[model samples]
Target: MTEIGEVIELNRFDETSQVDDPDLARALARRKATFGASSVLFYDKPIHMASASGSWMQAADGTRYLDLYNNVPCIGHSHPAVAEAIGRQAAVLNTNTRYLVDIVHDYAERLLAEYPAGLDNVVLTCTGSESNDLALRMAEAFTGKRGVIVTDLAYHGNSASTTAISPGSRSDRSVPAHVRTVAPPEAFRSGDNDPGGSFAARVRGAIASLEAEGHGCAAIIVDTIFSSDGVYAGPPGLVDGAVAAVHEAGGLYIADEVQPGFARTGDAMWGFARHGAMPDMVTMGKPMGNGFPMSGVVSRPDVLTAFCEMHAGYFNTFGGNPLAAAAGLAVLDTIRSEGLLENARAAGKTMMEGLRAMQGSGSAIGDVRGAGCFLGVEISEPGSNRPDAAMARKVINGLKERGVLVGATGPHGNVLKIRPPLCFGEAEALVFFGAMEQVLAL
Candidate 1:
């Protein structure tokens, strides 16, 4: 059986699993040669995707798989509006931040409008890692502290600084000297009556520890949905206490909205809003440009001004280019015009209800929980709460074999992560539920 933290790592290919197909084998060999040791392919038999549409992806082998694993294309995969906007802008002008671009300003205004009142400044970046890296710098500069806090299994990003805070990247790795890890608000397993208070208490403890260690807390960065920590978005206000604790300790709250932003939660544009905690800074990516590479940090003007004054101005070569801004604008416009959020809420509710009903009969299912379109189903022992990563792996592979695409997450990697595009509707939900039912039944 695969250990909790090791489940995801076990999905990668090893020397034993050799493909019989000559084409796939050649492609795999070429990928390995080019990508080298860092190459991490999904599943034992990876799918060579040829194209993707609204809720489906076609493999090079001509197999169409329902996509339930992607949140990056919030509106939908290959959205025509986004593609056209990018094309039009690229044809006209695709320059950096140095140039005066109306599209960049337009996107900034539109994106900033979605944030809370005080968070008016936007610093665009090319990826979530860069946004988070900037956020860490701002927090350290603003607080003059070197310490940061995160959930035990948190995954912020890939930069050197962010990697120190992202334990999910490698659970076997030791927590850095400047970072402290706290238990996530796991109401399901912890069974704490006051999950918010419990989480807050843990944050306070972590802050005290940091202070004692002479690295006073700088920020508590968290993925509001806790996507990497098993998708815990329940017990609204779970982070309220933690936010207060961080503020009280003169630390900032950096909401890593890379996974839950852009109405993926079906409740708000930002996940911090749903938790009722106002973050000092909100970092967003993934779905910002509907698959276009665009990310940003929305911060208080005062905080941003201080950071800018202290460390000079910040700029990214392709951060707020005309093409990116155009793509972002089209995504926002489509979200409103198509009512994707409402669809997510309705479809997600139906899907969750169906999963819960299945749980009543599925012995392997231990829990069903989530918010809006982001949901997680935990696979566990038949009569106990012990995580069954083996079962989870089986189910994930089974789903893939049955033409459904989903992934596993959580500290134990026993939770089925079902985060599809916001455009997923009743039809998609039905198909997903049917596939899930079949997989679980097996």
Candidate 2:
């Protein structure tokens, strides 16, 4: 069996695979020559996408595929409001922070309002990796410690510093000297009835280990939804004990909201809020600008002050530019106008209940978990909890062939990651569920 937290690099078509489409073959050759080892195309026979709108994406061959995998288009694909805002701002001015920009301030104020009281200051970045990297620095500067604790399967970012803390990204599962990893809050697999308490105990142990190593704890950063750790969202307040432990150890709790923010979790704007845990710092991305490449870190003013005083002030050339700010504002407006939060709640409930019903029929589904638009369906061996990556791959490809798009994620790569646009409705949900049933039957 593959080790837990190991990223399953799905099978991709190589030169040996027989290709009938000449254009696709040429495209694949060009991609290989250009991107080399870094090129990762989804599906065995990759679909060349032409365009996308709302919840539907069209392939180059004119086949329409229902998008159940993309979360970046939080409002919807090619949303007119966001596109218009970007265009209007780009045509007028697209300068950096060197200039006095009201739009930037306006967007910052709007975003900060969604956060809790103490998390007032905002530092925009170009991606979630950059936001997390900066948050780590702030924690180290404020706490005067070097150690960080994260979940065993966490994938924070791609930067050197962030990668040091993201064990999932590392092939060897090795972490830096200043980092320690704890088990995720997985209720299904855990023997203990009190999953929260069990998780907190592991966190405390990691803290002790870090302290003993002379690297006092700086922060306990986590994806509040634990998306990569099999999408574990608890029975409300499941993370309370863990947060308290971090606080008692004088460590900040940094919530990586890249996967669960922007009302993706249905009930709240931020995933940590779902558990009633207020993080000292929150990093957001993916849906911030509705796929306009914007991200930010929200922290208390005192924490920002300490970090800036200790080091040079921070700035990104493309972060929070006028165009990005406009797009972000437009996304926020669309969410309100469309009532996307309520839509996500309703649509997610339908999807979850449908999946649970399918599970009750004694299928290969070992578990169905998550909230709102973000959900995970674990494929496992029949009569056992053992993960079945082969089944997951089959289901993913089967869905693709049937004009539905979904992806595989989790420690063992057996969980179907279903996160569509916030605009996903009952009609779209029915399409997905019906297609899923058909695929499973096959």
Candidate 3:
């Protein structure tokens, strides 16, 4: 199996290789020249140019592809409401968070209204990384501890502190002494029995390990869905044990909702709500502004106050700008007016049923799991559990060639990650299956 955080070249474009399409070749060369080795592009033959709308993206050559992998534009690409709100706000006023802004409060009130009681305050940030970084600080400040526990393949953010806790960020770097890793609560791995309790026991062990090493447990942070660990959404209350274990050890539970928030899970507005886990702090982003770069942390007032009292105070120049707030407000309005929650519920059910059926008929699909719009189909060697990274790559590229877009995740890079925009519907789901069938030779 591939190591966690190891670069899966199977799913990435090779820079030194070749390009047949002159237009695409020229574009790739130019990008390579400018971005150098830091550039990360998907597909072996990357498509050039793109404009997108609703649930589809058009290639530079004007070919349309069904979108099944983008989660950033939760309300759909180029949504008119969000675009208009952003345009209107930018044309009128876009300023720093230092000033009092009515629209900011309006957005905050609407956003916070969905959160559980005592998660009464919100601190806006420019990205999920910033939100997680701030959350780490808050947990330390509140608990006076220096340790964190996370799932083995978890990816919280890219900041230095978050990187230390994110095992999937890199296996090259040794985990910091204060941070410990545990397996995610995926049902299949646990034989469909007591996966939740197993995950909790792992957390408890990690907490003890941290304490034994002189760093008391400060927090247990998780995405709940475990998207990077191959989309492990589950039977209800899966996170209850882990949350209780952390709390028992005097550690906070920071729910990193960057992946599963804003009704992506269908059953609830936030992923943690599905399991009824109460987080001491919750961080969210990506879909907050339908791709407008708005992100934030929410916590009880006392928890927030604890951090502020220990420092010069937290602030971000562009975090809660009126423009971002307008975009966020538009997203909220769209989710409500479009009935995306109910759509996610219904559409997700259709997808789950379809994928499960696909699994029964094919050896390539080892497993099918996830909730709502976020799901994963594990690709495996025929008649065995061995991971088939090459097969996964083939399916991904094959689907792409047939005008569909998806992604790969899991340490083995063998699971097809199928998370589309919240605007995804039965029509979009049907398009995905049509492409999947052809790709799998079913």
Candidate 4:
């Protein structure tokens, strides 16, 4: 077995364990066999995950990594509570929304209780993109407007409608005539101050641009934490003012909480809570089912009713099937009973402070920003904040070699996205930070 707390050398695994399991071997080989050689990003140290629990993942090669990118395992992978909940529901029955089930209503009621009062209605979908599509449809139906304002690097979903408004998505080769893009309230990029007013002004300018093009603004959709664009947890009330600008432009506001919802932020259960703003519609996903394929669009009852009246209907075969709902319920229960939110807050502070201290000391780190558990370290050239994605990739690869897995984001993919599961503890954070320091030094 690989030594605990020590990085596993790739040669060690290759020499010691020559598995004859055809199934696993075939599966691994298929990346090269079927999808060609370059399909995978084949890191120098790749973790063939075998098992996971709490904040750690054990690879097939018997190395343990302090996971910092697993938001899907919100309650921690293989949580006994969540497993039991899924088992109980699966053993009993797995059905659809057409059939009346008490668990469905119970889960909906429980989930809605987490949102603001008026935002009580929810429509289940299978992914954040679908949830966003549903939200867009509702916004358009309710207000008879089709124009949408989006942040410069905000990502929503992969669907066509979502891609239209997701400026961060590159597949949008053909820009939608009705969609407008605004700059995100990225304080770091906008010069280390509350960029709320400037960002809001950009929103108004976007609306003006759309109107100037004769496509009036209908809605403004924003990612609460701008996770894909590199966790920009804007200053309090920053997005509120942006929402106000959208509202003043006769447009609804949609908060895409796909990555930051379900209490990953630690400070608030949802990302909008950190912004201190009430969104007209909220799209959630990822941790909602704790790795199960499920997502949702939550909106005001009045807005939902308006869409309903307009004949807008949505139905996903397995969106909120009993199994997924059970998993979601278990996740929420685990969050409450285990105090993961508070854990996230404390651990986030420890990790962010560690990173901040490492900033000026190391020439690799440019800026460290984020809130709660969603932290990011912006990497740049020494003494120059000009984004250096090449060095960032080197840092990521170096960390991977050290047996620590982290992610990169930002437009240039230089911001290290430091979002571990909620169950991740300060101890794990300390280890990860140490690994980061070693990698930066290299």
lDDT of 3 at 289: 92
Candidate 1 residue-wise lDDT at 3: 58
Clash pairs for candidate 4: none
Give the alpha carbon lDDT tens digit for every residue of 102-216 in model 2: 9999999999888879999999999999999999999999999999999988999999999999988776778989999988888765556888888899999999999999999
Clashing pairs in 3: none
TM-score of candidate 1 against the unseen true structure = 0.98
What candidate 2 gets wrong by more than 4 Å, as runs, is: 4-6, 11-16
lDDT of each: 0.87, 0.89, 0.88, 0.78
Candidate 2: lDDT of 373? 93
Candidate 1, 1-442: lDDT as tens digits: 4554585585666635869988888888898899988888887688888999999999999999999999998898999999999889888988899988898999999988887789989999999999999999999889999899999888888999888888888748457898999888887666678877888999999999999999999999989989988888877888999999999999999999999988888887778878888999999888999899999999988889889999997989999888999999999999899998888888778888888887654488888888888999988987677788888888888888989888988877888899988988788888777887888787
Worst 10 contiguous positions by lDDT, candidate 4: 1-10
Model 3 — TM-score against the truth? 0.97
Worst 10 residues of 1 by lDDT: 1-10
**Candidate 4: global Cα-lDDT?**
0.78
Candidate 2 — which pairs collide? none
Superior candidate under TM-score, 2 versus 4: 2
TM-score of 2: 0.97
lDDT of 2: 0.89
Error of 1 at 63 (Å): 0.5
State, as a TM-score between 0 and 1, how close model 4 is to the true structure.
Answer: 0.90
* Model 2 Cα shift for residue 417 (angstroms): 0.7
